[model samples]
Target: MLLGAERGAGCYAARVLAKRIIPCLDVHNGRTTRGQQFGRAEHGELRDVGDPVALALRYDEGGADELVFYDITATAEGRGAMLDIITQVAERCFMPLTVGGGVRTLADFRALFLAGADKVSINSGAVANPEVVRAAAEHYGSQAVVFSIDAKKRPDASGWEVYVAGGRKATGLDLLEWAVRGQELGAGEIVLNSIDADGMKTGYDLEATRAVARAVDIPVIASGGAGNALHMRDVLLYGEADAALAAGIFHSGQTTVGEVKRLLAAAGVHVRLVQHATLGW
Candidate 1:
C-alpha cells in the first residue's frame, strides 16, 4: 500500500512523486461548456469557446502539465466526431492528452491512440462490458488505458456506487470492488470522479476518493469538486490521489496552472513548476 503523506513527502521519494494538475475541456456540439454541481448527469451552460485546437494551445501555453478533452455529447449522440478534435489538438499541443467519451471498443481506443492521444479514458463503455478494460490493456498497454468511474455517495448504502451513461444510469457495483477489478485487469490509472462533489467546488470528495485510491495500485486521479488551489492540494495530499483533474475553475479564468503550482508549493505539495508565456489575458 502507498503511504499517504503531507504535501512534500512524495516529491523527493524517487517515485516521481510530483502531483499532476490536469485541466479538463468539456466539448459539446464542438464547443466548450462549464457544467454545474459535479458535471455529471446534467447539461452544462455552453459557451461558444471558438475551436478546441485554439483552447488546447492556450492551456499548453498556460503551463498545464496535461490536458483532458471529454466529448460530453459523443456517447449520447452515438458518434465519434471527437476524434477529429482530438487529432487537431494532439497535432498542435506538445503535451500529453487524454481523450474520453464514446470510446466503447478496442477499435475506438486504437483510433484515439493513432490520432496522437497519449491515453484513452473509458467510462460508459467499460461499465457496459467490464472485459473492455482487459482487452484495452492487452492491445494498448496498461498505461494507455484509463478507467474513469463516476460515482456518487449512496446514503442508504454503505459505500459509493458507480454511475454510467454519463452518470444517468446507476450500477450497483461497489466502488472499491470496481476499482480493484480495474487494477487487476491491468489498468494503468484510475480516474475516480465524485458525482456528488462535482462542480460543487467544495473540494474533492476526499472520503470517496481515498477509498478508491486505497484499493488500487496504479495512479489514481481525483476528479470533481475543485474550486481553488487549496482544494487541489487537499485532494492530492489528503485524498492520496496521484493527480487532481478539474474543469470549471480553470475554464472561466478563475485559476491558472502557474497559480495553482505556487499555491501547492506554499502548502508543501510537490508539483512541476513551469514558466510559460501567458495567453488570453
Candidate 2:
C-alpha cells in the first residue's frame, strides 16, 4: 500500500512509495562493528558486535526489507569485496543485499553479483574515474549500481563535502552536485551517508538529505543517523528520503526491523510489514 508523508508538510496528496528499512553491517576485520561517527578500533571506540552472517540472519528474520554489508576497512586495506561472507549470508537470508567497499572495477561488480549481491556501491572508485559507475550501469543495468557518498558538513556549516576512503579522505566534491552527476551517469540509487552523523542517533541530517533527494531522480537512501522509529518517520516525510539505514541501534539490540515497521505503520508511513497468522496485527 502507498502512503503519504506528513500531510501538514504539504504532501497531503502525494503518493509516497513504501519506505524501505535497511540494516547496515559495518564489518571490520571480518566482524561486524559499531562506532560513533566513524571512530576506529584503535581509538578505543569501535566495538565488535557479532558475526556479520549471524547479524544478517537476525535482520532477515526480524523483517528487514533489505540488508547492506560494508567491509568498512576494505578500501583502506586495499582488498576486494567479502565474497565468502556475502555468499554465506545470501544463502541463508532471503532479502536483497547491497555490498560496498573495495569495489573499484567491473570485475568487482561481476564478482559481487556472482557472490549474491543484488547491488554494488562505489565511492572512491567513482570519484577517481566516474566511468566505472557508467560502465557498470551499462553492463549490469542501472538498478544494480548505487553511488554511495560519504559526506561531512563543511567546517563553516556552509555545505557538505564528499569524503572517501571510509570517511578518511576529503574529495572537495559538493554533495548535491555529485549526486546529480551520479544520476546523470545512470546510477540507480544514491546512498547519502553523513559522516558527521555516522553513528549518532539523535536524528538524521534532514536538511542535507532532502537536498540530495530533491536533486536526484533516483531513490535516495539516507544513512547515518536513525535513533528511533520517529527519526525514520521524520527523514522520510521531511527529509524526503526513500529509505533509512541504521547500524548501532539495531546491532546493539535497541530495536528490530519489525518493531520499527510497526511503529511506522501506526504513524501512517507505508512500509512492508511481515504477516503473522497466529499473532495478527
Candidate 3:
C-alpha cells in the first residue's frame, strides 16, 4: 500500500508512496535527441544534447528517482536498442533505469536485464503480441515489465487510440481497454504517453490519463506535455498518476528533478527531496 490515501469515488486521492519524477532520454543512433511532438530535426542533424551516459550521471546525482531511456528509432528501423548505451548508463547511474525500444521477445527482456536495466518497457512488440507481456512477466516477475502505451486522440473525439512504431502506426485499439488488458496480462506498470499532448507543453491530457489510471490496478506514469512543476503536481494528484515523465522540459535545462520535487512536496504531495548540498537551489 502507498503512503497516503486510498482511491475513493470521484475525488481522486493520493497514495503515500512519493510520486517519482523521471527524466526521459529519447536516443537516436546512440545520441540523445528531442523534437517537438516527435518531429524530425531540421536539416539532417539530430538535436544532439549531450552524451547519454554523462547526462544520466548528472540526473542521477541531481536526484532523479529513475531514468527512462527510449531508443526512439529502434522500432521504426527494425533494430534493437543500442545495448552499449544501455549498459554504459546502467553501469554509471545508480537509480532505477527503465529501457525501452525493440523489446520484442522474452529474450530481449533477459538481455536488457543482464545489461543492468531494472525494468524493460514494451510498446509495439506487446501490441503485436500481447502474450509476450504475460510471458515476460511470468519469467521475470511483473515488476520487471512496464507496458508503454503511445496514444492519440481519435478523429471523432470518442477516445484515445493506441499508436505503435514510435507513434507512426495506429493500432485502432481503445486506450482504456488496452490498459486494462495490459494489467490483466501481468504488466507491473503502465506508461501512458499522450501523442496529442506530447511536446505540446500545454499540459497533460488529463482526461486520458485519469481514465487509464482509474481503469488499471497498476501504477501509471504520465508522459509528455509536462511544462512545469504544476503540471507534474496535477498529473500525480488530480490526474491520479503514480509518476510523471518528461523529456523536453528536463532536457532543455528548463527544470531539474530536485526543483520539481520541492515544489511537489510543498504542494502537500508526497515527494522525496534531495539534500540541498547538491542542488544548491
Candidate 4:
C-alpha cells in the first residue's frame, strides 16, 4: 500500500504542473497568417502562411498542450467563414481547442462550444456586456468561459488599457480593474494579449501579465511577444502566468514545444512532456 500511496502522490504532482505551452493560430479570411501585429488602425500586411487546419494538425502532432484559433477579421463576411473553419479544425483535432473573435453574447459562446470548441474566448463582446461572462459560466460552467483582454500601455497611466476589434479600438479601461471584474463575473481563465509587444519578439510584457495573474484566481495565459524558449520561461516564471501562448516563434519553425519544455524544466518550471500521435502514420 506504500507503493500505491507513492503513485497517488505522483498523480497529484502531475495535476499541479506549472507553465503550459500553448500554440496560437491567427486566422484571417479563412487562411492562416504569421507575424501579424495585433493592433492596426487600418489594414496591415497579413501574409498567408498556410491553411489553418494544416497548421493546427502540425502543432497537434508536435505535442502542443493546447491550441488557440483567433479570427482577425471584422465583418459579417468574415464571421461566416470563420465558423466553418472552426468546425473543420474541430473535426480533425483531438486536443482541446479554444476559439475567439467576434464572440459577443451567450448565444455566440453557445454556438462556438456547440461547434466543438472546448472553451470560448470573449474579448470585445465581454467588455461590451460584462454580464455575458457570468451568463456563460452559469450555463456552460466556468471552465468553458475565457476572457481575452488585449491591452496596450497608456501614456498617461502606469497600467495598460484594454483594446478591442483586433486592437484597433481602445476602451480606456484600467487593465487591473477589468481583470478583477472579469474574475467576479465568473471567467474561468484570462488570456492577456499584449498589443505593445505583439509581433515585436522582445519577450512578453511581464509587468502586464503578472498584474493580471496576481489580480485574479483563474489561470492567465500570456499571449504575444514570445521570441524563443527563454521568453516562454521568463513569462511562466517571472510573469506568474499559468501558460504562455506564442504564434510566430512556433509557426515559423523557430522553436518547438519540446525545446521549450526542456528549457523550462531546467528553470525549475513543472511541465508535462506530451506525446504526439498522428493518424495513419
Model 4 Cα shift for residue 127 (angstroms): 1.1
For model 2, residues 1-281, the per-residue Cα lDDT tens digits are 11101111122112236788899999888899988887876677788899999999888878787889998878877988789998898778877788999999988988888887878899988998899999998877787788999999999988999999888899999999999999999888899998888888989999999999889888899999888878888998899999989988898888878888888888888998877443244
Q: Please estimate how well model 3 matches the true structure, expressed as its whole-model Cα lDDT.
A: 0.84
Tens-digit per-residue lDDT, 100-129, candidate 4:
888887778767776767777888888888
lDDT per residue as tens, model 1, 13-79: 3333688899988887777776664353344345555567777887888877778888876776687
lDDT against the true structure, each candidate: 0.79, 0.84, 0.84, 0.79
Which segments of model 4 are wrong by more than 4 Å?
1-16, 39-42, 75-81, 276-281
For candidate 1, the lDDT comes to: 0.79
- TM-score of candidate 1 versus the correct structure, residues matched by position: 0.89
Candidate 3 regions with alpha-carbon error over 4 angstroms = 1-16, 41-46
Clashing pairs in 3: 3-16, 3-17, 4-15, 4-16
TM-score of each prediction: 0.89, 0.92, 0.91, 0.89
- What does candidate 3's lDDT look like per residue over 189-279, in tens digits? 8999988888889989888999999998888999988988799999999899999999888878898898898889888988777674778
Displacement of residue 51 (Cα, Å) in model 3 is 1.3
Worst 10-residue stretch by lDDT in candidate 4? Answer: 1-10
